[model samples]
Target: MRAQRVEDTPGGRLPAVADPLRPFESRSAGVATTERVLFGRLTTEDPVQAVVRRIRTAIGLGILTDGQKLPKEADLARQLGVTAFSLREALSALRDAGLIVTRVGKNGGSYVQRPPASDSIAEEQLTGLTATELRDLGDWRAVLVTYAAWLAAQRASAASSDRLASYAEELADADTAAAARRALGRFHVELAAAAQSMRLTRAELALHEEFDWLVQVLLRDETHRRAIVRTMLEVSATVRAGDAAAAWVAGEQLTAYLVTELTRSRLRLIAAGSAGPGPKRRRAGDIVAELRRISKQTVGILEDIADDVAAGVTMPPTSGELNGVVARSVLPRLGRVEDLVHGVGFMAEVGLLPEAEYWMEWWQRASDGTFDRDYSHQLDPSLDDFYEYGSQDYLTRPRATGRPNAMGPYIDHGGVDDYLVTVSLPVAREGTFLGVICIDIRVAGLERALSPWLARADGTCLVLNAESRVLLSNAVRYNVGDVLPQSSDLSLTDVGWFGWVVARAPEEP
Candidate 1:
């Protein structure tokens, strides 16, 4: 334990410490600083992809303007908490994509390249798309934009509202097609931003990037351009007024207009044979109509069940008495229910009914003698949470508002463990809410019913719930419960399953 002599370096002298704790403290401090910095930048996986996404998002959002020089590679790498090699790889990908260019020697660095003209870029991106694919892309954009507008109306701040209005005004005043298209795109991005959801904003940026060319094409027509600007202004005004429903409708109208234009353009291209001999498109119209018919019928059945329960049960039974009553009364009615009805039950308000007393059809055979016994009730924590009064259970809203409602893309009741949609009707008598009558619709069965229709569709088809979680898919790429990635080319048709249905095709060829 001798004290070490201080050593002189280029600019400073460092005293050699004999105390082991001093060196440990200094090392720990260095580690702590490094960890903090890394925590800010490091993603859980795929640093290169993350870096690329960040830069691309910045560019797409106009945060990084054209010809803006990026920081030196080393500095950027350090900031992103990635290896220099990874940064170089990401930069290389960007360069390949024509988003950036690298220069060598003095004053040399990576600079963003100006984007290609919108029409040329759009033509290139859309070169291979068939009419069906273009229509589907339009539909998907419609859903996303409409939903974003609705949410923004509900939650946007005053500043966000003002910004949206300003963007709309700018779009209206834009004299040139290019200027109008740019403004229109910015208006959408700002609208999504007003929703106060980062995911939505990112999605908007991505969608705009994907369809910039299409917007350019549409904007070139003076009539179409003016109409779109007017639509944007109307949507902005609705959002500013905080009319969520109106905003949603406005957004949908705008989407419909755009989709119509796109469709006409696609048809023209097809007639010109520029789109090539398109794939044989199968119309899902009949199948969709059939599905809607079945869904409505099922909902009607559930409503009748609720009405029967409300009329029969004069007084709310205690938790201990509910199961026995349901067994004797409700279970027999459920027995006669359709085979597609996986399970039917009554859920009492929490604390009013014991968890075990929630009546569910557990019989293997219904009263109609069908082999329908594949259901169970386990005390799943998630299911228990769902049964609570304020939960997203179909019954919750119905019970609260005295209106029927549907909720889904959720797992089975009581954690029985199957993806299903629940349609519930409020059981009320004389203005008193008793409980909820719920019917579980087997998503698998519905998919089976639609199998013929899905088979007819030109490409793969997915039925996605409100959360965009797949309830069923004929595509090998997706499975039940898989969340669909946001893409422009996915065609979405709203079917009657808890605001879910028919997402088809993919962006890739």
Candidate 2:
């Protein structure tokens, strides 16, 4: 039957077609014109599996080429008559298959993947098996593989036998752990295929993932892996020579060797642990010190920017300044200076005025404690809580409260040029507020300035005002203008990534 679109009508009823392909044809009294496709002929009744199959088939057929995208999840759900949850499941399965991948950003979305077939075995190994798990896998593999080889000797055709033999002969050239594993896995898969039983073939193919995992964990190096590959190859060759019993004996030998090696490897790891002050420990300490240095430097640069702003005396009003909320004259002097205005814009966009106020205070302190705080929510436009939240204690402290640390926003809104630098003047003179000022440094600039520090550290930085509007960010994936919600009251920290900071220290500045 031909496929047809089900159209919805103005009355919210499904329209019945007399003859969809040839419209205007009338139906007879006794005619059965309901030409719906049968369930068995259609895809899986399980919506998730159906969607997964569609995506896989689309990729396989080149209908969904690499770098191509699919419809958004909600739209897909509506088209497929499935829930968003089902669509997510289908996407997860496709991701696991290495046919699709995801990225997060303003421009980001799911994409078709074209991973090399060469990496499939490695991916399976990395995702599936651990060291201890591999030892157990080795035991099962020894038993089943030996049986399969013995059966192959009794049953293989001439062509299949030759294929198996050819794979075995290639093992001598495998000089690396990865190469040996691949060559050996191919040999086993071929041996199973030689059995001429679909059940056995599928069982082996199905077990390939487990096999890859075991090889990854148990086989530690070229020497250890090469030994296993050599033994397995020999077993298959011996079987092909019409000695089934010899293959079984070879399997037992391999299993014994693995058990002994696994025991020794565990003991060595244990001994290494008991002996303290290893290279990894030193590396970890170095990483921590480097991170601390980066934080201090970032803070320093931010303070310096503030001081610079503070040192430059604001030009005295030659004439009374125009009274207006939208003052175009206050625009930044540098493209980077536009960043501070952008920061305010982002805060306003996210309805985080209180947080914005806090940012202003931090900027002032970093700059040497003298800058104006524009409190009217109307001017800021991003602040949401003008009536509820007040600025009574705002900028009144003589010394730093040490309460609202600039650290959190610095971490949150962090990016390249972000730093804490400050400038100062000897005396409070003339119209100068305090001869000191601060600002949240730009992310891009901070990153470039601290390239040395960043190369050694892997951390995040962000900036938000008192109203919780994200003004700037060093988190690579976070998009500007995302109105991030405040931390949940019930939870100690937020549930989102990096939300832990909010929960871990509710009283954090």
Candidate 3:
């Protein structure tokens, strides 16, 4: 089923998906994420094998968690875009592997049966990797973790900063590897959240997914584990102190130390000559999952923007500037829009959105029906451009229909001077349409957030817009905006209307 225009929010994985209870600190909103991630469309892999891998990835990553019952056979097949027969073959394969149990009749369905320990065969896992690959992954982790901590120090609230410190303590007290891994990964995830950029948060989750299991081999040792927790706490302290430079150094040091430990583990494996392939490169499923995460956080921010507008700028909204709300000489209600502009663009203070000053804009209809436009960005629009609001689909579509509209990957050439996608939803109270809340995400940021995951795919892949235009691609043959060729050689997999990926079909096994 399609999401209603006003209700077009994608099912997301971020904790900030508007939960009143345990918001920002809990796991996802629950099963919708499972549906989004595990039951998403299959890429170009053998369909049966693809289905098996999706379930295994979800269970292994704890997305499905221990003992969680999978949906019914028919339901699972429907979600996966496979037939019932193919679904059964996949489930039977899982049963044979002892990953799931099925007891039918009454009160019965397939239930996950995860092993108590993860695959700690680091020797085998690292044997196939070269020095360059190891160093590259480590460098990526360092850059991602360091910037996350630095930005968190600069932007995190007092409560959240203290929570990071407290979370570090939780890692110190973690008794088991499973508990420790969760704490370790959550520490970075929490740090990303504190930074308040959805793109950063999505990127952190992507980084964690690819290596969380690999890190457990090191965590199995008590000495290495304690060392990790100790350094994490120290970095958390810098973040709590709001010292960005200190946080940067501490976070990098922590990640670098872990990289050293992993390298040593790999070196020992190589010296022993215990050769085996490492885990599979991440797949297109992971890309879909990352997009869902970004979608969820974007929705969270969009909701905040909508709520701010719906709540009214002031008691009467006609009252003169109050609460530091700046009134525009052109219109006072734009002060509300101005407040919204600041509200949405705060996510870019640390460089997620470079020209973030113009990232948010509100276009509203007044009582007399003329449109009033305000930007959160400090720069004023040219008089002619400000007056020529008719061309903005971000405003016109939503204002006319009082619904949602997503526009662009188009260049904001005359405006922000960047490639941007503007996602907007109508601001309404009761039956009235007031305005549209427009949030412009940098296409470059989207590319950076997704590039890490797409690069992990073993083969070439490209994410396409609903119209089959490329939005992101790992293949040089297909750049963003290129129309993907219609060919029997290409396999296009749709993960709902939000996006799709095109890849080459696997050869028969």
Candidate 4:
């Protein structure tokens, strides 16, 4: 009302206007652009919560951290591929939730803020767990899992139900105790994930997260591992037979089994001079002993394979015989494969190999869309039958003898795609060293075990033969019969009743 006077028009009137909704302003660093779709179905009821849930998950994974600055509006908008207006709306909502705080000034930026610690305590309380609450969470887990099993029995698709039965068969056929335990644990997790209850699924996943620390402590007690497996199998059978009530009863029984064994575990830890074994204890020594045992057993399996292969027995090729197999001989035919290579002044975007023995005949496609053909077989090395020997000098040498080197993936080769694993058997003839029997497993139903690790943003795992041909992989473009890392120190062993050596790809030099 006390403002300066305005100039009057011919009619002595002032202009009028409507107010506009301006976007929020915040001082934050820029973020990378990426589109993110929410998990499950996107519905109208909780779209904001859905977005919030994904962001929270990223935070949990350390993708976003406390006090880390957020992206600027323009960058954030670009990264999310959403309009700045939409991004601002989302940020405003987050600010109200206290997940972010804005700052002003040349050096100032928005940062992820921490909530009060009281929220953590409330979550713990809602979980109904505490140090004094119970020494074992198994009792509650037993009830939940048993209920889940019953529901799975009722609602699981026929294929899923059949898969459960098949896993049980595998459990029965497990050559080692370790395999049995792994298979057993896998069955439990899969069953829970397949269950109809989201709560059960989440609880099961939480159980695995908890197991990371607890497994070492618990596995020292063989009885505990055995009891869990036995109980799981029992419950699995009841569920498979469609007896929900019986499955529940079996689940309770499994919990009891765990309870007794956990008591023993507690006793052992107590006798070891503390309520829980830790830095001062002999845990490290025990781990070394276990590793030694595994090595010994793995060597034994290699020896057996070596004997069979050396004798010219019908041992399967590491990735199977691709060249000679007739279409009638197998259910599925060979598929296309792509190669990835790094060369001088160039890196690979994608590569394809022609059916040729000489490296000079092969072609290289560069990331920048350039292609070159080089055919010096000497430089190429055999695309197949290469072993990965550890780094030595200027050249990575291949194994001189036929004997399979002792470190590689555990592939169950020669089986149907639905039942595959990498397996290497050491080979020797008349006590003379030959080569190893190598097999590339087609891991049919166990995609879950492989997919999670293989689908990671970085790193990859693969199974190849002594010739360095690709047999199977968790990542990267691979097809059956593709040439792979030829130099491997891959072998087989039966260290324990259950033993496996997982192969990790070498880092770029």
Score every model by TM-score. Answer: 0.44, 0.33, 0.42, 0.29
Q: CA lDDT, every prediction?
A: 0.62, 0.42, 0.59, 0.39
Q: Which candidate model has the greater lDDT, 1 or 3?
A: 1
Top candidate by lDDT: 1
Query: Which regions of candidate 3 are displaced past 4 Å?
Result: 1-63, 71-98, 274-509
Candidates sorted on TM-score, descending: 1, 3, 2, 4
True lDDT of residue 177, candidate 4: 43
Model 3 scores what on Cα lDDT?
0.59
| Residue 400 Cα positional deviation in candidate 3, in Å, after optimal superposition | 76
Question: How many clashes does the backbone of model 2 have?
Answer: 61
lDDT digits (tens) for residues 137-237 of candidate 2: 66666666777777777776555555554544554465544444444555555666565554454455445545543444444475776676667666666
RMSD values, in order shown: 18.3, 20.6, 24.4, 25.1
| Candidate 4 per-residue C-alpha lDDT over 218-261 given as tens digits, one digit per residue, 9 for 90 to 100 | 43345555555566667767767777788778877865664434
What's model 2's TM-score? 0.33
**In what order do the candidates fall by lDDT, top score first?**
1, 3, 2, 4
lDDT of 3 by residue, 1-509 (tens): 22122112333222223321121343332223333544566554578977887776666545555566677676678768887888899999999988899887775778788767654543455545543346567778888889988998898777666666666677667677765676676677667777776657656656664555567768778898878877888887888889999999999888877876675565455434312332334233477766665666555556665665556454323212211221221133334331112122211111112332223344434445444554523432454444333347766677776655566657666655556667766665565554455566665556545555554554566777656776765444455566766763667665542444545433234
Q: Show how many residue pairs clash in every candidate, following the order shown.
A: 2, 61, 1, 60
Question: Which candidate leads the pack in TM-score?
Answer: 1
